[model samples]
Target chain A: MIRMSNISWRFLSVWRRNLIVYRKIWKVNFLVPLLEPAFYILAFGLGFQGLVQGLSYGGKALAYTQFMAPALIAISIMYNSFFETTYASFVRMYYQKTFDGMMTTPLSLEEIILAEIVWGATKATAAAAVMTLVLGLFGFVNFPQGLLIVPLAFLGGLAFGAVGMFFTGITPSIDMFNLPIFLFITPMFLFSGTFFPVSGLPEWAQTAALIFPLYHLVELSRACCLGLVETNPLLSLGYLIVFTLCFLVLGLTTMRRRLIK
Target chain B: MDQQPTAAGEIILQVDNLGKHYNGVSAVAGISFAVRAGECFGLLGPNGAGKTSAIRMIYGFAPPSSGSLRVFSLDVADDWRRIRSRVGVCQQDNTLDPDLSVLQNLLIFAGYFQIPADQARERAEELLHFFALEKKREAKVGELSGGLARRLTLARALINDPELIILDEPTTGLDPQSRHLLWEKLHALRARGKTFILTTHYMEEAAQLCDRLVIMDHGRILIEGAPTGLIEAHVGSSIIEVSGADQELVDFLAERKVEFDRMADRLVIYNKGNAEIEQAVRAGFHSRQCTFRSATLEDVFLRLTGRELRE
Candidate 1:
């Protein structure tokens, strides 16, 4: 078993360094993700609210803007996690060869993987936090459980970040990343009950949606924001925790094989 | 003076018949060598000669397809972490973060080794001063010149005061002055009893900096010795260069008793000094320039590996 405290300390160091590196390129890096979510919030949430009728989720009448706001925040977290972990990890692994430099030191492959996941999660959290504040300012979301949103957004980030690293381990070139993002991630973002509920879908599609960890994350976020806590919040949390552990293990193992051989 | 107890002439690293294959072809095949404590051993090979592949195995970047590697008497398969902590490597490429400043790059690498932040900063400062990069401490790595970037990489490798430092083509793209500066720094470090394993295609660099080296080609060691010893063993005592020779001079020398090869327009006489060749050239031929010099590592390389260009 790996020591959590030792790994946490190492993760924090790598996370802080990644943040500093991003801050230097913040003019380009921050603007892209920040503007993307804001555009989605404005165009899809606020712009389409009047056109679409109200929907009933868990016996509560909610407008499209209010219904989509929480999921949008969750989506932001996923995008941030995925983007940060995959592209940045690729650059560090191949182009910059920064991981090669680190592996030459006392840092183990486990520590490096943990550090990358933590950094991705942190970026996801920061993006989600900013989007949450922006949504609050626009009065699009009235989240009663504001405190829960932050940690849940972070968990959502962790889930996607771990999966991103798993892909990073297998990516042979930068171009291969496009397939996973377009084929897998786009479908997950669209069909995971984000824009619409999965209640009326076919049984196979619904079952497949359930296989996506993001769907549960979106559900958990929506429940917390709408203050509709259920008896089985633990189930969704357990699902997310399990997903995180599986992806983390897979990413660490693959990275070990790629790096340490 | 905190004088530490040092190992007395102990072999710290060993590789036995190491081999690595990519796809169906072998990149490094059945090559073997050992590095003693505090010795600067060089792997002298041209491009595609598998120098990087061998170094990668030594640093645990990749497992050898066959053979064994031991560091500090510990097998690499079992003690990779311990071995990594004790070794520092500077790869052929510039691996520093382009967005990070020079000092920040070193500090981040230090953190990888789990050095505390304050101590990391202290070490970065000392390294910057030592490398003459203190003035550019806050400059982003992308803005630094190639020489400064290379120096910073060297500094980053020294952050942990590693026992064994591996430099793969450390001076590849630098100017002559920068190359000399880096060589001087490496020599100084060696004087302080740090072991270094370097690989380079530059024969002059191998001769100047490496205490002993092995000549490698086609993924195998062709010969191994001190630079002077290899030259003596391969190319004999001296070289004579005779220029401005006409076809008549070439024909006469070819028919007469002389061992030489035509390098461009100049006839280079092997295994003999200028005085003997000068007498021969004056007696039977004419030349505008005739000079003699002792054999160099370059001559040894050309003699053993032919003058044909390797793709």
Candidate 2:
């Protein structure tokens, strides 16, 4: 059972701590999201546009770049939050002993862990905002409607970050993180319809893709970017919300077990 | 600094029958102690003797398996947040934020206690000066030397201006110069009436800083008293070490009912104001390896904990 008293506004202190560090090398941090989408757009847009012809997505025929542009944003959302909580948080917890230091203060383990998730989501939101602006230059994102993807990024970030943090809690060492990144993350990155539409895959494969959280996030991003969605927006939103809450509780529980022993 | 006043001789920490277990293996086996305000108490023990476990429990870093712990008269289980706000902990590990500048480390830590930005900055500056870290304020923690980083950690712990400070082996790996500097700072703080709970295997540190201490081994308290008192009570005022000891000297001491530790190659005779014993051992035995020295806390620790190697 989660003790509600263990959580408080004090978590912002941890968030602020992360922000100060991020701001130190922010130019380097922002470079990835800003240029990553362009790299993918150039690679796919120029290489595949001629051979692939018009692609059908969300019941609308479109250019190859249009179909993959929103997926790039969704992919960035997943990577930013996932990597932040998994590798970065692991270093701080295991190698740096930052969490152990904070535990001696007024902050509880719940607060520190909660701040990690929130900060991960904040990073995703920031990266998504940068990607959205970069993708807009390519005429892939619609104005005003596309801004909603910022909030969607945060939701997706929570889902991914919470799951990543859960992996961190159970992981014995920093080197062991390669297992989840290889098995769990790589699979999702491929089968989540980030590169191509899921409908093109085998019937069983398409059904399996529905279980991947990244697929739902891609669907929501497409809805915001192109005004078209293959699945109901509410269904995608609800799936992300449920996934985030479940993994968040699991992350906090496992972390408490790992650190509070 | 004295805005939050404290009354001396009042109980600041009360640990009763505290026990901790890992996978059913006990780390702390039901020990109890109390610390009054304005006194430095020491927990002296070797590795795996549960000093860290007990320290963790006192700072509310870990929950005790059994018994009650009250800090500042508040139950740790019920009011850990409140208790933590008033307690400063300098962990055994270097937990400084390496990504931050030396000053940012202190400022950010103060934020954890919900200290106002202005107040935190003021206290941070004061601590930087007090710990002699003002010169490196803008330097990243990664750039600081081990001694400087440790000093920064101690400064960070004081950012909240806590009433009680808990230091776990604060000077384990420092050079003699650094250790002496830290001890000097600790002494200065003690003079200001700050309460501290320190854990260290360095008997000299305990002897110099602790008003009272408990020597622990194998998850049990073997003795508790002031450093000088423990030495006086257990090992007396002096010790005579006779290396290359033989059965003849052992027989001589055994005949007199003199307490001594017979080891594989040497005999340690606990001298309680006995100059004749030293004289006889040197002259009567013709042992060239005999040496006489004042008894210290180390003698008491080795005698109580034994010379057996502990993993």
Candidate 3:
């Protein structure tokens, strides 16, 4: 087995390098995601509340803004993870050939993949945290949960980041990236209970939505932020954990083959 | 029964009958060579000659279909990571991160080798200075000229002080002055006892930089020796070029029982010296220009690999 400390150090170094590249355009980094969650809160949470009526869970009516706040946070994490891993990672892989540069060292393919996932997760979690504060400022999110959202956001990020990387491994060009974002990610964001509950959908649609890990992420984030931890939180957590492991393995293996072969 | 000396130096790398096939066509046929410590070995080949494939095998980037390869006493199959840590590679295409400044690129690569941040910064600065790129340290790699980018690539390869440096056509697209600068830098590094394995198509580059080299063609070794030795063995001492001359010299040389090859507009008289051939040309044919010079590695390459342009 390789040394753990070496792997961790390499991962942190790669993470720092990625941050340096991102810091070059910090305005775009902060402003883009900031506008996203705010737009979602104003347009969907406030505008659609009058049309869709209240959401009743356990015979109690939850405010539309509060019910959707955690889901919006989950969506932001997923979007950030997907954006960071897909476009940014693809640029590094194909255009920059940065992985080729790194592989010349002692760093293994596993270390590179893990480092990428960690960076994506960090970016996603930071965006989620900032959006969470924005929600609090607008009096939309009222969770007293002490930083649980951070780890959940991280998990959400890991799931999407791994999945995004999996797509990137198979994508031959930057234009092909649209297939995953439009066909899979956009549908998940719209129908995976991000802005509304999935219960009202058709049985087949609900079943298909259940297949997406984002549905579980939305459910888990909502449960944590609303102080309503269910007895079966493990189910959603288990789904995300399995999704993360599978995509991480697939992404890492495919990328290794693509690079080393 | 035969025996060869096995104690010249430790065989740091060995490839026995290595081959790589793409789509059932061999890019690199069964070939074998070994590199010893402190030797600047070269693979001299034209484009599409499979030098890249061979280097890829040595670095464990691609597994050879049929070979027993070893690096630093470790099997390539089992110890690639260990081997990679001790080796550095500069590919034909520049691999610097374009968005990062020159210094940032070096620091990031040093980080990949798990160097401490402080040491990485210091080494990056030193490498910048070594390449005469200290002034451009803060410039983004995208802004550097081709020569400067290549220098940065070389400097980055030396970040970890690798024991084995592999360069694939490292000076292919540089200006003459840039090429000379790179050669000087490489020579200085070689003086410090760093073993380098480079592949280049330029005959002068091979002659100037390589201590020993293998001429490769169609994925196979055509000849291997020191540059001057190869020229001496294949091309003889001197070649006389007579341009603007016709078949009269050829006929005269034939009458004198002289050996030569006739081209469309010139006759290449291969011999020990220009005395006999110049006499023949002066006595038989009225030529516009006649020049005699010592044979070069280019002639040796042409003789071994033929004059056909390799696509």
Query: Which clashing pairs does model 1 show?
Result: none
- Note the residue pairs that clash in candidate 3: none
Worst 10 residues of 1 chain B by lDDT: B1-10
What TM-score against the true fold does each predicted structure earn? 0.89, 0.98, 0.92
Writing each residue's lDDT as its tens digit, candidate 2 over A1-261 gives 569999999999999999999998999999999899899999988888888876798888988899899999998999999999999999999889999989888899999999999999999999999999999988999998999998999999999999999999899988898999899889999989888899889999999998999999999999999998887889989999999999999999999888888
Off by over 4 Å in 2: B1-4
Candidate 2 CAPRI assessment class: high
- Comparison by TM-score, 2 against 3, better one: 2
DockQ of 2: 0.93
Candidate 1 overall lDDT versus native:
0.81
Q: After superposing candidate 3, which stretches have Cα over 4 Å from the reference?
A: A1-9, A57-59, A228-231, B1-9, B248-264, B272-274
Worst 10 residues of 2 chain B by lDDT: B1-10
**Which is superior by DockQ, 1 or 3?**
3
I-RMSD for candidate 1 = 1.9
Model 1, position B240: C-alpha lDDT score: 70
Q: Compute the DockQ of candidate 3.
A: 0.69
DockQ, all candidates in order:
0.64, 0.93, 0.69
